[model samples]
Target chain A: MSGDHHGSSAISERVRHVEALLEARGLVDEGEIDRRIDEFLAGGSPANGARITARAWVDPGFRDRLLADANAAIREVGLSMAGGLQEQRLKVVANTEDEHNVVVCTLCSCYPIALLGPSPAWYKSEAYRSRVVRDPRGVLEEFGLELPAATRISVWDASAESRYLVVSRRPEGTDGMSEEELAGLVTRKGLIGTAAV
Target chain B: MPDRFAPGDAVRTSTADPTWHTRLPRYARGAVGRVVELAGHHPLADDRARGLPGTTQAVYHVRFAAADLFGDGDHAVTVELWEDYLEPADPSGGTP
Candidate 1:
């Protein structure tokens, strides 16, 4: 049900109408919208997030900086959330032995698109948006992620301008792994906190 | 406007459900939570959504216990909220 196409044509139709209106008013030139979309999409991917997470796993100082000030720290890795006119605020939360963090936007599909690429289809689904906030543990279980009963879960709802990223705990036995090797272990779900790295 | 609340302050979200657009989600309305961090000033999203010149307001990361929000849970939930959406929590007012 992730990419459920129900009512999508209606949305696309409405969007086309608005785009046509804008174009006719000279507000946007022909092909400008598609070009901008392509440009933005080209700049984003899960690799950017994985690279940042791998650096943090190996560097304590970098991890501290990233958790303290994500926007500035991401620049150190040559990644940015400044894809739009106003840069969305980024806050990186780390999972710990006793705590598990998950990110969700209950209102809409607000996400760190520049850092983690486009959101997964499930992320924007009504089931996720409604249930994650109410039953995060259940939702995680559905995602095949099960934490200890004692491990406290903190669900970060992106209801404002700030977007969140979860820095899952570095896996054990990976101390000898190189940064690139560690990065290879990261997935979009891990960054989104729906799975452990 | 000047920041009305700081990190660690207890606040309750306004329960008012405006017919127009608002960033204050219905699930959070009237709930009490403690401010975790001051996320700096951002334009009031509700006003911005209405095509008006929005005023900047302090946004905070507020933490709410999951048990309190959803009846029974051992976890917690955090939401970034604007200053206009919150008020100082009344110590005597029982949880919503």
Candidate 2:
């Protein structure tokens, strides 16, 4: 872990050096990088994903669209996975009575940042990446999610062009809740499939 | 190019260990899996990483049993892989 700290700072230093060079050459205007970062940060948050999930729970049609075509479905709520040069493909997997779904990027932390905000440190750590694909039940148990032995577990590795999102099953006794209130129950971990709503 | 494999087809990942960048992880290499879905065509990440003039290829969502990769689990692991990284699996190749 200590090495990670040093490694990160070294990377940051290198990035700063490159940024300074770009700014000095007038290739990039000063403060443009910060503005872009701010723009992305303003649009990225867990709330975005929560709102989408809440709509899916309350509107069956929206849920169907989300499951069928996530990239287009997100635009219904004025959201997009288009921060980069090209839009990233999104695949929404829903949890059902017979199965559970979880997402991971073993090579690197390729997450749905526009919807889920930044990934948690644990998600990017070597322990979770290496072990989850191998021992999912054990890892989920450590996360306090104890599933029945018969329940199937699906570990999605986002190693290619597509990203993944897990829609946790709606909890019981919440039919009276409104869409906004339902969104309140969603969490980053829940969207990531590490925890239930 | 047309999709070389379709959903429900059995495929095996390439075991080649290239020094260049690749999206294929080591654990899934040489593993037999079933194609679950077509993830559409996209530029190959390995060639793109190296700044090569890569062409678009079909990407498939392949599902592999955890027991096949790790030797002791009932769960499944799915990965989106480019067509170039996979080949038709031998019919006699036992369940991974």
lDDT against the true structure, per candidate, is 0.88, 0.89
Reference contacts preserved by each model? 0.87, 0.96
RMSD of 1: 2.2
For model 1, how does the per-residue alpha-carbon lDDT over A78-172 read when each residue is reduced to its tens digit? 98888887888899999999999999888878888888898898888888988888999999999999999999999999988898888989999
Which window of ten consecutive residues has the lowest lDDT sum in model 2 chain A?
A1-10
Write candidate 2's Cα lDDT for B1-96 as tens digits. 578999899999999999989888999999888999998898899889899988899999999988777777899999999999999996457645
Deviating ranges (above 4 Å) for candidate 1 = A1-7, B90-96
Q: Cα lDDT for residue B19, model 2?
A: 95
Off-target runs (Cα >4 Å) in candidate 2 are A1-7, B91-96
Candidate 2 docking classification = high
Instruction: Give the TM-scores of the predictions, in the order they appear.
Output: 0.95, 0.93
Query: Could you tell me the lDDT of residue A131 within candidate 2?
Result: 84
Candidate 2 lDDT, A83-113, residue by residue in tens: 8668989999988889999999998888999
Clashing pairs in 1: none
Instruction: Evaluate candidate 1 and give its CAPRI docking class based on DockQ.
Output: high
Q: Show the lowest summed lDDT stretch of 10 residues, model 1 chain A.
A: A1-10
